[model samples]
Target: MTVFILVSGVFTGAHVWEDAAARLAAAGAEVHAVALTGLGGPRDAAGAGIDLDTHIGDVLAVIDSVGVAAGREIVLVGHDYGIHPVLGAADRRAERIARIVYLDAGMPQDGVPALAAVLDQSLRARLAERAGAGGAGGLGGVEGADGELPPPARDEWQRWGSTAGVPEAALDRLTALASPQPLATLLQPLRLTGAAAAVPTTGVLCNGNGASIEMVQLRVGVGDPALQALTDPRVTFFELPTGHWPMLSCPAELAEVLLRAAAGEGHRLEPAGAAEPPVHLRPFLLDVPEVPRERAGNVDLYLPDAEGPWPAVVFVHGGPLPAEARPTPRDWPTFMGYARYAAGQGVVGVTLDHRLHDVADYERAAADVAAAVELVRADPRVDADRVALWFFSGGGPITADWLGAPPSWLRCLAATYPILAPLPNWGMVGSRFHPAAAVAEARALPIVLTRAGLEMPEIAATVEEFLAAAKDCGADVEVVDVPHGRHGFETLDPTDESREAVHHAMRSVLAHLTA
Candidate 1:
C-alpha cells in the first residue's frame, strides 16, 4: 500500500482536496491532506507569525504521524503554493519520500521565495518592489498591518489561477471556505539541502492553465539548461486537460493521474543534446547577401547599400527568453537574417535587445522597444516617417501598444507566429498587452500576420483568436499561412512553405512601408 500526502495551495487547506482524497482512498491508498497553518480555516486561525516554516512543519508533522509500514511507500503531492512546503519537507526527508508530485506549479529553486511562483505579474511586481525597498517591512506593508493577505473575492479568483472547467458550486464553496494566507509564507525563501534532487519527480501540467507537455518539449528543444535537466530519467510529466484546480474540476481524473505519477509512469522529454545548437541558433534559412551592420546602444541596424534614408523595419524578437540565453535575440540568426534580408530589399532593418527575460518584464520590454525605436528613427540613415514594426513570438503582445493608437509615421505592423492574447496561466485578463482586443483600433494601419499551421495549440489559439477579432473589427489585415510550418519555422521547419511565407510577409510589410 502507498501513503499519499496532499498539500493544497494558498488561501485554502486540506479541505480543497476532499474529493480527490476520497477518490484516492477508495482506490486502496491511504491519503492524508494537510491543512497548513493559517490557511483553510477560519479568519482568526491565521496570524502574522505564520510563515513558510510553519507550513513546512505542518507537512512534516503529517509525514511523521503516518509512519512507514512494511512494503509501504510515501508519495507527496503539492499543488501551486503548496509545493514550497512539500519541497522543504522532502529536502529534510529525501529517503522517506518515494516520489514528489508538482501539480500545476513551478519548480522553485533554493533561496528563491514563493513570490517568484506567483502568476499575477502586477501583484508580483508590486510585492517584489516592496520587498526590495523595505526589507522585512516591505512585504508586510502590502499584506496589511495584520501581515495576512486576505483571500481573493469570488470574481477575482482567476488572478490566482485559471478557473476554466471549475463548477459554479465548487467555486462558491471554495470562496466560502477560503482562509487568509500569511504574508511571510510567500516572502520566506525556500531552503533545500541538495539531497532531495535524488528523489523521483512528477510534474502534473495543467494544459488549460498554459503549461503542457508540448510547451515543456519546446523549451527543452530550445537548449534551455534549466529545462534540459528535466530530461533526466528521474523526472516525468503528465498533463491535465482541465485548469489549475484539477481536484475541484476533475477529482476522479486527478486521482487517477496521481496514482500513475506515484508509480513513476508518465511521458519523458527527449534531450536536445548539447552537441548541436538548438534550431533557433541555426543559420538563417534565407540566403540573402549580408548588409552593413551598425550598433547604436542596444539596437542593431542593417543598412541598405544604396540608401540615403531608407524606410526601416524594426524586427522585435519574441521571448520571455531565458535570462541566460546565449547570443541574445538581436544576435540570433533569425533576427540577423531578417534585418539583413530587409536591407537587401532597399530598407533599413533594425534588431534590438530588450529586457523581456520574464513574463512580468513586458512593461520594461515595451519601454526598451520604444526607446530603441526613438534611437533608430533619429539615425540619419533611416527615414523616420516610414517605419514599420514586425514582431515575433512572445514579443507579439508588445504590439498592443502601437495597435491601439498608431502614430502617423507608423506605416504598418507585422507578426510571425505571435501570441496575441494573454495566456490563461499568466493570470491576466483585459491586460493592456492583449493585442487581440487592441486590433480593433488598428483600422487603417495595414497589418501582416504570418501563421504556422502546425504551431503549438496554445499559441495557435491566440493567433486564431486575434484573426477572428480582426475580422470582426474589419481591420486591414493580411494573413500569410504556412500550412506545413511550426512556430519558429524559419529555422525549425525550413520548408519551402516557410521560406515563401517569410518572403510574402516581408514583401507585404515593405509594400506598406513604401506605400
Candidate 2:
C-alpha cells in the first residue's frame, strides 16, 4: 500500500516522517511526511508555497506520480491541523486512495475543534476562568519555568493553523511562509451530508488514557455530537500509549496500523469487532431514510459565500424507486459543494425532490425542477441568468430530456455519472422534456455531460446521441469521462478520483458561467 504521511500539529516537516517512512518502505510500503504552509520549519520559497490548496496540490502531484506505479490503494496519514489539507488532497484524489489513517490526529471529537478535545475536563474549567485572557482558544500559555509562554500572535494563528511540539529553530522558518489560511476552513461548517459524504477515516488516538481526548471530552458533555470526526461512518477507533507527538515516540506502531488498514485487516473492522456504529448527526442518514413530508416535497439549497443571492442549480433527485420512496438527502452536499465552489467563483447551487406520478413519466420531475428554479430565483438571493441545472443517476435523463423541450432560463448544464437513455414510456410532453425543442434557442449556452466507466450503457449511448443533437443545433457540448468512479459511486464513500473529477469539472462550469 502507498501511504502519504502529513504532519498537522505544531512544528511539522516532511523530515519528521524520515524514520517512519524508512520502516514502511522496508516493509514494502511508500510513505511521505509533509508539512503544511506555515508551521513547518522551512523557508516558504525554499520549498512549495504554503497555501492550503498548494499544499494539497503538492500532495496530489506526488500521489499522481506514485499512482502510476502502484498495485493497491493509497493510504493518507495526517496529524492534527494537517487533516484539512490532507482531506482536501484526498477529496481531490479520491480515486487514488484506499483509506486514510490519522495518527495522533483526527477530526474533532464534537463541535469543538481538536484543541478542545485534548484538554481534560478540569483543565477546561480552569481555561474558562482565563477566557478573558484569550483562554485556550487564543493559544496563549502561562509563563512557565522555561520562560514566558508564547501569546497567541495574530499572525501566528491558532485558528487556521495549530501546533503541538516545535523547537525554536522551526519558529524562524515561518518568515517566508505563504499567506495565512482562509477563514472558511475554521468558521465554515463542513457539510458531509447527503450523497457527498467524505470517504471513511480511522483515528489513532494517542495521549493520556486509551480513550481519545475527544471521547473523554464528549463523556463530560463538552462538545456537539456532529462536530466529532469520530462520528463518520467509515471511522474505526484505536488507542496508543504516547502523547500528541507520536512520530517522536511511536512511529513503528503508527506505521503498522496504517499498513494494516491499507491491507484491510484492521482489528475492529466491521463484524470482526461488533459495536455501535458512529452516531451520524448530519442531514443525511445512517440507514435507509424516511422522508417526513412525502406529499409536500422539500428541496435543499446550498449557496456559495462569494456569489450574489445565488445562481441556482436544481438537482432532480435520481432513483429507480417511486419519488414517494425516500431518497434521503439525495446529492445535496455533493451538489451543494460543487455549487458553492462555483459560487465562490461566482454561481449558486440548488437541489430539489421531485414527484413521481402514476404515469411514471420523469418530465414531470423535470418540470418540477424548472418550477423550483423559478421559485428559488424569485427570492432576492437568486440570480436567474446565472442558473445551471445538474442531475445524477435517473435524474440525469430527467433533466437532459426535460431540457429537450422549451428550455427554461438555464445559463449552463452539468451532469455526472448520468443515465441518459430516452424512455418510450415517458412522452415527448413538449416542454422541458423535449430535447429537440430545448436546443432551438441554443446559440450560446454550454452543456457538460460527464460519463464514467461504471456509467449505464444506455446512458452513455444517450449522452453520445445528445452531444450530436446539441452540436447540430449550435449548442456547446463537452462530453468527458473525468470521474472514473466505480458502480454506485453515487452511494459509496468518496474517493480522490471523485473529488478531482468534480472540482476540476466544476472549475470549468463556474468559469463558463462567469465568462
Clash number by candidate, in order: 0, 25
Q: Write the per-residue lDDT of candidate 1 for residues 135-243, one digit (tens) a residue.
A: 5456664645467677888998888888878999999989988988777898899999988999999999987787889777866776667787799999999998888
> Mind giving the per-residue lDDT tens digits that candidate 2 earns over 1-515?
46555555433456666556777898987666665544444333222222345556666676777744556667777775566556666766776667777765535322343324222233333444554455333423432211111222434432222233333443343323333332222322222222213566677766321224333222222123333444445666665655454554566876776666666553333321122322111222112222221122456555555536556666555544333332243433444344445445545555666664322445466677667767776768776666667766556656544455425566677777664543221222222443434555555667776667654333454556666677777777676564456433433435666656666666666666565
Model 2 lDDT, residue 2, Cα = 61
Query: What lDDT does the true structure give each of the candidates?
Result: 0.88, 0.50
Q: Which stretches in model 2 have alpha-carbon errors above 4 Å? A: 1-297, 330-333, 336-346, 357-359, 400-402, 405-409, 424-441, 487-493
After superposition, the stretches of candidate 1 with alpha carbons farther than 4 Å from their true spots are 42-44, 128-145, 221-225, 272-275, 427-431
Candidate 2 displacement at residue 223 in angstroms: 33
Clashes of 2: 25
Q: TM-score, each model?
A: 0.93, 0.39
Please tell me which predicted candidate would have the highest lDDT against the true structure: 1
| Prediction RMSDs, each to the true structure | 2.4, 24.2
